[model samples]
Target: MDVREIPHTEATEATEATEATEATQATGAAHAAAADATAAALARVRGAARAGHPRALAWRTERLTALRALLTERQDDLAAALHSDLRKPRSEVDNAEVGFTLREIDHALRHLPGWLAPEPVAAAALGRLPPGAAATTRYEPLGTVLVIGPWNFPVQLLLVPVVGALAAGNTVVVKPSELAPATSALFASLLPAYLGADTVAVVEGGPEETAALLAERFDHVFYTGNGTVGRAVMRAAAAHLTPVTLELGGKCPVFVDRDVDLAAVAARLARAKFANAGQTCVAPDHVLTDPGTGRRLTAELARAVEERFGPDPAASEHYGRIVNEHHFDRLVALLDSGRVVLGGRHDRADRYLAPTVLANVAPDAPAMREEVFGPILPVVHVAGVDEAIALVNGGDRPLALYAFTGDEAARRRLADETRSGAVNFGLPFAHLGVPELPFGGVGESGFGAYHGHHSFAAFSHRRARLDVPIGAA
Candidate 1:
């Protein structure tokens, strides 16, 4: 049975227009509903904060325990989600993402009691209060905090900040990146069950949803992503006069010394550079060394990639795939920027790119100019340590600086001269694992540090108080 369509008339056209308007109205209403839902959730968390539930040590500990359980009990689920979202290897997922966050939680739990105590401070001599005056500072929670996680390291970046915000006795609203949908959905589903709806809530969506969440006032806003989005977060936060911690990424540099073990250095560089397909914030963005060392290091790097990921890294179980096709294409275009030393293979369909090393790369090349957040390492030739220092100082300070040297003078010079978030002697990206050390960046790379006590301090406001004997004066 075939039926022919009626000829176009004013009445029929008007009916079609009315239907389109209704559909548009329905979409707007749905969006309004979603925004209202987010607003309502945020209001609940804010109410919880005002009630002082999170201020109790017992309450903080209970939440931390639940977070540990979530990681330990449902790790397989998280790993699978990460694999689906970013093609992250199971082993890498366990160590880099899950284990790293667990360590942070453990550290926070152990030190939270001491961290919560009020700290004594010496009274200022210039502005004397009285004859017998005592002063101290108390760490108070900054109400509800908004934690916006990046697509790279979705779980760790999102949850780690929550650990700090919670430990500091603040409720948190987590917005997981929509790019990693599987992980984001996993978090949105699992977090409420573990942390409770009132303490920690997960909101999932893209830029529009993020903008909606940002519209509301928060005590603090912690964002982990590229500088562009970091700036946007800062701009939004400014509307509320809210404090923010921008954990951003840039072209982190590595300086290779001629005296160091080339083989071991190459192996370590490969491990750090290619881990999670080089989507790490502190991954060695480029290598700086003398021409002679560069030649030897280049060959050793080629051997290291083959040894670790095997000749055909695409087939290797240890190697990870790029996050998405857009990133894969961006990485493919970078190969043309410099002479490929070892790896130049890429499969956009599989989102697989080999651990590539480019040598004799110009300083102004695209890979060098931008943060090459992929498994691509570019080696730039420098005259000596002085030249390397000059080059590093020329750009915006990076999140981390890696200098491989046994020389005391060189180490001291590099330590005193350069500006970066953290400095590692031989290894790169190792500073993040240590709970004692603060992880963050300087200048354009980012601002504010957080890990153990730093995390506690970052989320808490230190309010000063003074008590004086009025009768004495």
Candidate 2:
């Protein structure tokens, strides 16, 4: 509100100080004065979004409509950036990162109207009111949105939420992780030109800049990263009283039932583990299979990893490197407690680590204790599904859970007993392969859901509106 709108008085015999005055001010004027400064700024963003102005909506039907074309046109650029920064392959880029993101753009464009439409109500509550009353719920924009994305899958982590914000009629400010400098810069440069600056703005920096952005009041905040930073983001959002949806990493578990298909499990586990060198948040941290099954899986996965990326990830161009030696050393130090069953080689200069899977790991071992985001998968042997569920629930809730089984009853039991936000049955790692699922975490893994419609709703406020029939009598 302006100073004139504050109901201020000049100091004199005629002017009395309101702070010390015991007299009452007009309620309407008091409400106007109490209106937060951020309300107007947020309103402007909502207005811009509603207008779908050329400068505001930016990409609109053109980029949203031609997402595949744009991605195909710029495929080399994206792949090159990921390779330069993360050491991923051209094929991996198209299938994992670019593939799903472009698909999300297309999916959101096609279903955006359904997402944005105000919901209808049954007037159930209105029946309780005196004869002529009625009520209806309305949906609307949350105004300005803040997205704090992670270094791993930096492009998709950031833009996926932006897709939702834009679709739900809101402007977004994306803070891409500085760890992946190349991709971050690429997004900063590419997004604005393709999608205008007014609707979407990318601020490229580290924690300090992120802290500054968090300090600024916003209508909503969506963060994707590790739990430590996610908690800090939550704290900052709380200070501003801003509602946030945090997508954080956890030790997602994978259970292999006795009746499971060993060959298919080996192939699926290998793809998920070595996809980005196992740098993904929902990547399976450890496996719990029967002693017989665990041993077989270990042998099969070793072969699968070798088949997919060859004997040495250091020499394989397909295998990605750790973001830095710090993370490489972190994983290296953790390997001391367990017997290295597969690969454990690391080269600092190349920043390469093999698809290392450790066997005979004790529950208290470092690999089991925390999230091993590297290519190392520790296969922990348990008797059956009950033991596996107990082990999974022993720690905090993971972002994703994978249980491979042909038994229908056992699958439902596993799903019910666990606390993960998402569960995949009959597949080792189902988080990435399925686009229909909403991905997120619970408890320490983090809160909020994203992907498809779940994300579109995350950046919007579910406005509880009531419409009363004027003369129903």
Candidate 3:
């Protein structure tokens, strides 16, 4: 079957309506303020960059060091803000957000000299050149960059790209998600003390502010959010010919083979899917397995959820609540889209939804149609690997894909056939921990990547240099 043959979901319509409603809530005066603030920030960054402040290796290193110190010193404050904004546990905040960011900083600092060094090109390719001729590709900073972060993983998503952009010697404007107001305020307030207010400015507001920011010119734009906002960012960047690296989410799928360890699969899936209330970009959106494997996996998954979040997940301190009422309702609507296998409890007042598993869901089910950025796990039974691949490829490419099997052929087939930002054999979302791996999406999931050298390259331009002999004759 053609990939486009798969039906789209109502979740897209729901998300667009939500985005429109939220974007319009901000007033005209707010838009004016956002535009003025963005303009002023852009000017300051451009001025600083022109003055040769951020270009120095020492300056870049110092700024990265200061950012690390900021995360370390303000860990408590950051965690508290995250809790207030997303109901994320302090431990989750530290491990998933702060720790990951610190690692990125450390990785960049260690390898930045080599990354910035000019790569020598073989002069042999240009036989017409004089004997003294030399060629090299130098990675240079993109002057002023904009980092538009998402509400989920607000701290990490916002500042990780800043780590790369700053390391590449560019001035930055960070626009944190308005959905996470507390974290946004914390970033705007605290970033100045660490990275210097003038060099890295944080603009905190809704879509109007983001739209205003995008209207201005920038050397590079890095955005992490839904496809709707991502398209808007791309359009705005297109007008100015600004390069963009979008990190959008999609319906990441997991294919399970009969030979897998059901218990291990359950533990890994439960940890990844339910973490941060399943608001992760790379989390497994759905599962495809044969009937026997599906039944066994579902049983194991129920036990895994009970083990992690306990019978009353709402009371479990480890589990998080839904980000807000809108998302909570979205998730609630999905529960009805499939047959519940385990844990369907919810509380709208607290914005809580238990780690849920829905079995025997149809391909056209609302929950299966879109990126289910929630704790709802829909297990759709498939005949085998071919069916699973067809079902997955039928939709837009996802940010990540998982196949659980010890068979080498199965792994190879999945790797060869599917398109995703990353593919893994045993677990999900752990690919993000490796700084060496580039993280982002493909197709509808997202475009471009950033992490390690990828981040440096993404934020920097490769300028070709040549030493042309004056006596060319």
Cα RMSDs of all predictions?
A: 2.6, 12.4, 10.7
Query: Candidate 2, residues 380-435: lDDT per residue as tens digits?
Result: 88888888888887898888898888888888888888888788876645665555
Candidate 1 C-alpha lDDT tens digits along 303-351:
9988988889888888888888898999999998888988888888999
Residue pairs in candidate 3 whose N, alpha carbon or C atoms collide under 3 angstroms:
none
Colliding residue pairs in candidate 1: none
**Best candidate, lDDT-wise?**
1
TM-score of each: 0.95, 0.85, 0.92
Which rank order by TM-score, best down to worst? Answer: 1, 3, 2
For model 3, the superposed segments whose C-alpha errors exceed 4 Å read: 1-37
Q: Name the best candidate (by TM-score).
A: 1
Clashes per prediction?
A: 0, 0, 0
| Clash count in backbone of candidate 2 | 0
* Deviating ranges (above 4 Å) for candidate 2: 1-63, 66-70, 123-125, 128-135, 432-435, 469-472
lDDT of 3 by residue, 355-422 (tens): 99998899999997788999999999999999999998899998999989888988898999989889
- Candidate 1 regions exceeding 4 Å error are 1-5, 8-23, 123-132
User: Candidate 1: what lDDT?
Assistant: 0.90
